[model samples]
Target: MTEPQGALLVGSVNYDDAEKTMRTASAVLGGRLRRIPDGEVGKRFHWIMFQPDVLGQAEGIERVGDEPRWRRDVDARPLRIADGVDAATLQLPPLGYASAAEDSYEIFRRLRDEGAIAEGIRFQVSLPSPVAVISSYFSSDDRAAIDPIYTAAMRRELDRILAAIPHDDLAIQWDVASELGIIERASGYGRTMESWWPGDPFDGLVERLAALVDAVPAGVEVGVHLCYGDAGEKHFIEPKDTATLVRFANAVITASARELTWLHLPVPIDRDDPAYFAPLTDLTETAELYLGLVHREDGVEGARRRIAAASAVVTRFGVATECGIGRAPAGTTEGILATHAEVASAW
Candidate 1:
């Protein structure tokens, strides 16, 4: 089969700043990357969970964690705690998605004008799915109650982003990690992702994700990053195969009203067997499929092996690392970027 057509940066590049991320990635990958992130600096790896803490400090919600919730080390603030309290009466203040996005837009515009970034590439903004944040921070009873509220709050953040940035130059990527935990029924970090929904967990997940996709305006590019988890650069649970991911991707694609620009799924370093990619035959979405099969350990040669295996099951695809490389050890960024350039030809 022909070599993979392109490469994608699944957010969070390991760089000192956004300028370096845009300039360096554009120089190396050039037109291969359809979108580029702001490198998710300052907050490190929290992603959108930082919104809640920002909201907690805002007017409406109260910050209640003297000690970490559930004895786990996290920076989340639960909006409700007592069982008898009313969830409906509460409304969180806006999470300031517009401000953050517009701030980045300034940098993006200057870079594009200065030829640091190629024309036609969208500025990709990756937001954590609502389920990921609600499950991580809120108690079980509080999760269902707070989910709608949090979901609405998050949509408002999206609204801000969409309104501020030019739709033609923007792409919104919903990062779906915790939902994978729910799918696999995986237990880790001293908690289990038991399905609280009355019916199939998959149904609940698809519904939530579809709503997220539809919330973005029609003119903008949108995508879903079907992540397992990225803590310590390892999945919360290694997928037995691609079966669950295939099911999830197909479900969301069929249910979504808007066109999906792309769908990304992680491929474990050790899983190059055709069995791991066999289920991909069932994926029928027109969105670009980016296999997160690149690994810094084995670099280009290893990525080529994984890509060869994936090619057996699909006619076409792109390449990426299993997850964001920001958490990767310092000083390894150049090698990782070079691996992408080496493994895949530019689009």
Candidate 2:
């Protein structure tokens, strides 16, 4: 037996298409977009927003004499985190999306109706992780106040969005890389296990995320894509792992969703190859994992060897690009996605 086809090895498709495309939606478009000048979102922060003694740079909250740390607006609601060259990173609408969630669902439905997605492909609809949204726009100075607001806003948006879609046809993969494995240590965010970066407040971030997943309607398949920092292709960071990830995977099984997608790099860590998916062993038995076997750097031969190597360790596994194609050139993104399908199809 082989892994299923008709299965989609989907990665995060930015939310830009969700909103920009909405302008054309007769049913979704409400109020005049022109009323909100495009220049508003273009504004940038002039001062470093938040910095801590640990991460030295304060996790983007620090500032120089006069420059702003980030260019985020306290109130601007962006659909994605930021539109990178590859994908539109999305966020929950700032002002409650009373109807936009439904509208977003409708848009995806039409795509399927139009047969735009390949035949028999399963979808892992990408939604921004709530933690990333709050941290990005809201200054670290007031994250306590910002978190509640963010959660409420996201809950309403997801509640309606999940309600609108058919659970079986569409899958949900919340894009969150905040506490992804051992990456936190790279920035000096935390020095010991007892204390987490910034503060112990974010200690339960995974728990909160798990709750969000469990809160999803019983029908939609929910997946969690966890990775280290995703700044850019050649980001100034190294790789590492954490016991926390294993704990989260164990708890994730209780959630209502069917699948849990994990992002595993194809490269080696300290010359130690990821020959076996030891992490999957700790995950709940209920969900299936989409092993990220293909690399943005791989060719056909590399892909074949990777498939064989990854399959050797996985039983109930699917295939996908190591991570989102955001920032990767279009050609790289296409190759990464297409290669995954081709390799998976052969099985």
Candidate 3:
């Protein structure tokens, strides 16, 4: 099988759904913590490897785009614990999380190096927002200070790492959870419609993004993967018009990246209608749009109609599932990719 080149999912790192692929992987994830983190507090990503189908491309999800209201189960605990540190303290590597994160990345690194996914397919890496993590655990000042320090530090480390990597094949992404309206609500950070969710500690989110965008060494391109909330239900505040996209997406578009991937629900606009993304109708003219047209069971007919409908609104099209397939069964993800390729061909 040949590799797909035009902006398919490089791979999914964090699964929005809490479900893990195996009991062993789940045990490995659960083993890291001495105590569980609150549903509201944040945690790091699993080094989970998404088994790739050579004929497919993946989609992006913010984190958990659904399942937020499931009353916190006794079994479902938070991913980390209080370490008695201020927001700055939150940065000192959790009792066991960060080290595991690094170790986990090893599986992903090997897959890319060995061409397990797609030989020439572009691959990318991601992590949650340091600011979001700080805000979830500490106050605003602590959040402000922590993201910058981490941003500067991570930028330095990635500079060397990216330089050493084969940029033609690899890329990096910073998945900022602060912007995801649902996760923020659980963590008590921000709302969906508020222009700038007060106490919205992500002010540094933008700055850190800019710094990293500028600092990424040549040959490596950077992009952002944004999600509305952990799950479909978290998108509070009815989307009245395209203003939310105008406001939130503007900052992202102007930042140092060249790509913007968003979840697109099905709409009634005419397939021939000029008002394609009548909601995000006012997107800026710089980055590309990976119209999310697939979900757990969406099919080729539905996929083709919707993708064509969306492309009419904004052109630089890419076929994608509603979100990542990391938590979805490897077989389920395989079907999603097969459909994505079929739809892309139709477009």
Candidate 4:
């Protein structure tokens, strides 16, 4: 039987603690997973805004209105600017990225040293693109003004990660979920991702992401995770096919100065049809392609169907969950990891 060349863990692993997440995933998947994340453990999943909270407390920044609640997200009430702050004149503080990266790296190194994790696997750090955070927190008017500052702040976090972690053992994956809403022009679930750029939305998004991809140094491995929002275990909008993903990937590939190490695209559980994978033919990047074909509901059988369909168009690929399994019910993580092992031969 034909098997996938590798397997990817799309950042989160749904564990309450980081140590358990690393040890468990390494044992089950072995060398198949080239990188492992901390399951986005503790407060990360819904609390992605914690990083922005650092900026909200800066000297010139003030909360304009009562924190506005995102549509339908009961727990999400994010800080907005009190009055317009000049984007050019703003002096925002460090967004607590270095501290966080250092803390996580400690755990990563411990596992590797103890022989829990195989040598040569990277400790993957998944970060949301600044646009995703801006779209989630800021009002439509504030997105453009806030974007540059936030992007710079996020880059500072990357700088810390680069300086602290060994380049060979690090992989940075940028999560690009919100950009899809803008590209598809779909009002994702209850929120609207206002496009701040003037020209074609696709061009704007590609430029934004390409700049981010280029920001990483050459020695460190970097990849992009293209997602349609994963909330309530459903996509914010179901992708009609892979055409949009292919377009975005191709543009980024052409525009980026540095080579991307991998590209991860989510596959909806029901999409086993070959047309869904057809647009992949236009892709010519040497980066490994990992399809989010493993679903908690269908396990190995469903993954095989999706893999077979994808193989018809693209000869080389890997396997992963459509999004992080952090939000999945706690007990299901091992089964999901086992499914990936069952469906794909590890790299």
Candidate 5:
């Protein structure tokens, strides 16, 4: 089979900071990458786990317990609207996504100017869908009340990121994990993923995410990362195949106002069979398709098997890991990057 030509870093890296992530990715992947993320480092490392700490600081929000919930060494805890406090009136502090992006962009700019990174790569910022934060942190009773409020707050953060970074050099990725949990009606990390909204939950999810896709203006590149929960380096539930993913992708493409720059779907490490990839034939969206088929455990040969399976249905695509590598073992990041380089040709 012909090798795929590009690679994508699906947000988080296990590096100490953004500078190391960017510099190292540039040195290893080089022209293979079209965009680079800030490694979602610091408190942002464990995806949306840091959000409870931020939300807990809001006037009307309080943590459910004094001690933090332990999840792979990250401090994650549920939140609730404080008694008799109007969720609507409680103003949330800055979510920190925008400020993180802004800080990282300065480092990205310096490195590019110094010839450490290439000229054409865009700085990618990955933000969680409002549902991800609300569902993960709040109770079902509180979700509807807090959904619109948190969404607006996230929009404000997006606006800040858009204003601070140059449009031509920016790409925004909306991370959609909880939506899949809802779609599958499965529990992730012991919590059931259910939508509190009335009517069909699938439609609600599609519309919610499509609005986020359209929120990015015309010049900026926008994409969606369709994920199964990546807690403890495993999916909350291993998908039977790509059927649900293809359906979701087609729905989002039809629902969105703007063309998606790319769409990424995960491929389980063991799924290198033709049946597992057959559903991709029904994927109607015309965007850069990226299969998250690279696995550090099996390296280049494993990626090649999944690539061969995917090639049976989709003629063109890019390569990435099943999800961010932030939770990966300490010494495995470089090997994973090298695996992508070995399987896909540099752009």
Candidate 6:
């Protein structure tokens, strides 16, 4: 089979800081990556897990439990509107997405100027969809009231990021994980992810995500990462096939006004058969397809097997891990990066 070209870092590398993440990824991946993310270090090491504290800081919002819920070593308490406080009138504080991106972009720019990074590669900024955040952090009863407010706050964060970073060097990615749990009606991290709003959940999900896609200005590249919950390097539910992923990608493409630069889908490590990739033949959109087939355990041999399976349906694509390597075992990231470099030809 022909080697896939290019690679995508689905955000979060396990490095100690943004500078390390950028320098290491640039050194290891080189031209294979069209864009690079700043390891999502610090408080973002666990994606979206730091959000409850940020949300809890808002006026009229309070923590639901005295003790925090622990997951993967990070703790976060669920938040809700305080007693006698009107949810509709409440304003959310900054969610930290823009501040992180703006800060990281400086590192990215400095590295590029110093010739540590390639010129054409963009700096990728990954943001969680508001639905993913609202559903995960707020109770179902409080979701409807908090959704719009949070969404507006997130948009403002996006605006700040746009203002701070040059559009030509920017690429924005919406990380969509919890939406899959809701779509499959499965639970992740001991809680069921369900939509609080009435009506068809799938339609609502696609529309909301599409709106997010359109929120990015035309000059900046935008993409979507479709994921199952990756709480402990495990999906909330392993997919039966690529059927749902294909359907979701097609729907988002049709609903959105802007064109997607890329779309990434996860591939379970066990799925190396043609059956797992057959549905990709039905995908109608032309966005670059990235298959999350690189596994640290199996390395190049394993990625090759899945690549061969995917090649039967999709003629061209990129390679990535099923989820971010932020939570991967210590000392596994360099091997994972090597696997990507080996299986996929450098861009």
Best by lDDT: 5
What range of 10 consecutive residues in model 1 has the weakest lDDT sum? 67-76
Please provide, for model 3 over 1-347, each residue's C-alpha lDDT reduced to its tens digit, 9 standing for 90 to 100. 11111323423523332222212221332221111111111232221111011001212101222332222221111122223434343333222223333343444355436543323433344544444443443332433444444444455446555645566654555554445443234333342322123454345345555555555555665555554433332333323434444555566557744443322222221232334456555666543455555554556666666655565555565545444444454456446555655555321
Segments in model 4 whose C-alpha atoms lie over 4 Å from true places: 47-52, 59-75, 89-91, 189-191
Give the worst 10-residue stretch by lDDT in candidate 4.
68-77
Task: Give residue 268's lDDT in candidate 3 (0 to 100).
Answer: 23
Question: Tell me, what's the RMSD of every candidate?
Answer: 2.6, 10.8, 11.4, 2.5, 1.1, 1.3
How far off is residue 92 in model 6, in Å?
A: 1.4
Evaluated at residue 301, the lDDT of candidate 4 is: 90
In order, how many clashes per candidate?
A: 0, 23, 13, 3, 0, 0
Q: Rate residue 203 of model 6 by lDDT.
A: 95
Residue 7 shift from truth in candidate 1, angstroms: 0.9
TM-score of 1: 0.92
TM-score of each: 0.92, 0.63, 0.58, 0.93, 0.98, 0.97
Which residue runs does candidate 5 get wrong by more than 4 Å?
70-74
Q: What TM value does model 3 have?
A: 0.58
Give model 6 RMSD, 1 decimal.
1.3
10 residues in a row with least lDDT, candidate 6: 69-78
Off by over 4 Å in 3: 1-7, 10-91, 94-119, 137-145, 149-160, 180-205, 232-242, 255-276, 279-281, 329-331
| Candidate 2 displacement at residue 223 in angstroms | 1.0
Runs with alpha carbons beyond 4 Å of true place in candidate 1:
48-52, 58-65, 68-85
lDDT of each: 0.81, 0.43, 0.40, 0.83, 0.93, 0.90
Candidate 5 per-residue lDDT over residues 1-347, each given as its tens digit: 86898999999999989999999999999999999999999999999998888888899898998887876565688899989988879899999999999999999999999999999999999999999999888886899999999999999999999999999999999999999999999887577789989999999999999999999999999999999989888888899999999999899999999999999999999999989999998998666889999999999989999999889888889999999999889999999999988899887
RMSD in angstroms between candidate 2 and the native structure over all alpha carbons: 10.8
**lDDT of candidate 4 at residue 197, scale 0 to 100:** 65
Cα deviation of 73, candidate 5, in Å: 7.9
Candidate 1 on 1-347: residue-level lDDT in tens?
54987888888888867888878888888878999888766554545556556656544455556754431233655554444558776767766556667787889899999988889989988888888877876666777877888788888889888888999999998899999999888985578886566898889999989989999888899988988898778889999889999999889888998889999999999987878999999986666889999988888888888888898999789999878888788899889988898878888
Local distance difference test, candidate 5: 0.93
